[model samples]
Target: MKKILLTGATGYIGSHTALEFIEKGYEIVIVDNLYNSDISVLKNIEKITGVLPKFYEIDLKDKQNLEKVFKENKFDTVVHFAGLKAVGESCEKPFLYYKNNIIGSLNLFELMLKYSVKNIIFSSSATVYDSTAGKAPFFENNITGKTTNPYGTTKLVIENILRNLSNHKGLNVVNLRYFNPIGAHKSGFLGENPNNIPNNLLPYVMKVAIGELEVLKVFGGDYDTEDGTCKRDYIHVMDLADAHFKAFKFLQNSSKKIYEEINIGTGFATSVLEIIKMTNEVTGENLPYKITDRRAGDVDIVYCNADKAKKLFDWQAKLSVKEAVEDQYKFVINQNNKNK
Candidate 1:
């Protein structure tokens, strides 16, 4: 069995992807610092997969401790997901974002070069695309490098670095620019568990539904959409996990050193109000919400033209937004029960 190194493996998407890799019969190791995620997720993954993956509580920023892990174990590939990801927070502290996301990624890349582990699946974001450059749906071929916040800027910079570094004879890189990811695993054993107040829409909505938060603060409600709010292509977390699996298969069959970027999304735009309505439908209660000013660095409408992912990987989202809402609600209720 090929062993994989998963940075930030305890994170929301990383944890789900770890389960997927295990189910597909791959041996995996997890590395996370528990910055934004909890340590208990490791147990949850073991509960679902019956295999407690070897985990390292090391940060990517700590090069010495990180190097020790690489020296001791051989990794066939790496799925890089460690970083500070809040847009507003990134705007507040650009330097911190650059240091944590870019510098840490650079350290990891250098280590990869040293160890001769060339294959990688980078966790990129749609924010790297300039929404004002074109229409609603962004394609892989669309020009990037225009981002509104430091968090996205970090992703853009790392992507450039990866592209340039992949020019070497053996390095193979696949950068997956993800759209909004929501929902939880079907078992309710794993879900989006942010350490602090949630930043993403689905998590925030879940908090409101469970009475942890009084009202869901809708970011903007006067955008150019049908509901006068921002619209995004929110893909389910499990579907996002499946894309990583497909990417691994695609990378393994490559004959030459190649660097490819693909967008992973559902290719359908759902507005802010639509998400709230969906949440209400799942909970059977009209959750209280208040429309607020548009947050800085937020776009009006940004979804994906996911044809390239389908053409390349034979993968597209299988879960519906309604199902995502239901799964998210279930996870939130489970967590609430645990706290009580």
Candidate 2:
């Protein structure tokens, strides 16, 4: 069995990917600091896959504890997902974002090199694209390094770092530039559980549907789209997990040193109003929302050309946005029942 190291494995996407790996019969070692996630997700994973992953509660920023994990386990690949991800928080505290995302990544990469783990799949964002270039269908070769926020800048810088490492140190890197990921595992055992107010779309919508929040604030409504609302390539989290697994397999079979950036998203774009409509249809609850002024740094449309992922890894999103909404609603209802 291939031994994989999943950073932030207790978090939303990480936990789901852990299930995918376990189901594929891979041994996974998880390392998370429990900052944005809870430790009980391990139980959820066990419930889903009937396998408990070896876990370490070590922050990637702590080089000492992180290196200890590397010393003990010989990993075949590393799927990196540990970082501060809030865009507004990143802007308010750029130092925190840089120190946590960039420094922590540096420590992890150094340890990977020391342990001779040459294969890695990095969790990147489509925000690395130059939104000023205007609109969706962003390809891998599109202009980058024109990010409008600190969160995106960190991802761009990290991609550059990975590119340099791949060129000089013979490291094989696959940068998965994800569009908006917004669903739950189909089992309803795992899903995004943000501690605070969600910064993303679907989570916020779920909150309103569950009566956690009063109303959803639609950010922009004057964009150059059919619905006048900004459109995004919202993909299911499970599909994103499959993309990671396929990318890792791609690296495992490659004979040459490689640094490839691939877009992982559904080629279709959905507007905010469309999401609200879907949520209403799924939960049978009329979601309350308000159209507001466009937030700063907001783009008109942000989707991707996922043909590269299909051509390279034979991966495309199989689940639709409607299906994602249904699964996410199921997860919320399951969690509510559990808490009650």
TM, every model: 0.98, 0.98
Return the top candidate by lDDT: 2
Error of 1 at 170 (Å): 3.0
Global fold similarity of model 1 (TM-score): 0.98
Worst 10 residues of 2 by lDDT: 129-138
Query: Residue 213 error for model 1, in Å?
Result: 1.3
lDDT of 2 by residue, 36-84 (tens): 9998899999999999889999999999999999999999999999988
Worst 10 residues of 1 by lDDT: 163-172
TM-score of 2: 0.98
Please report how far candidate 2 places residue 26 from its true position, in Å.
Answer: 0.1
Candidate 1 segments whose C-alpha is farther than 4 A from its true place: none
- Residues 1-340, candidate 1, lDDT per residue (tens digit)? 7899999989999999999999999999898999999999999999999999999999899999999989988999999999999988898899999999998998899999999898999999998888789797889888788788899999999998999898854579999999999999988889999897788988988888888789988888888889888889999999999999999999988776779899999998998899999988888899999999987666788889898889888999999988999998888888888889
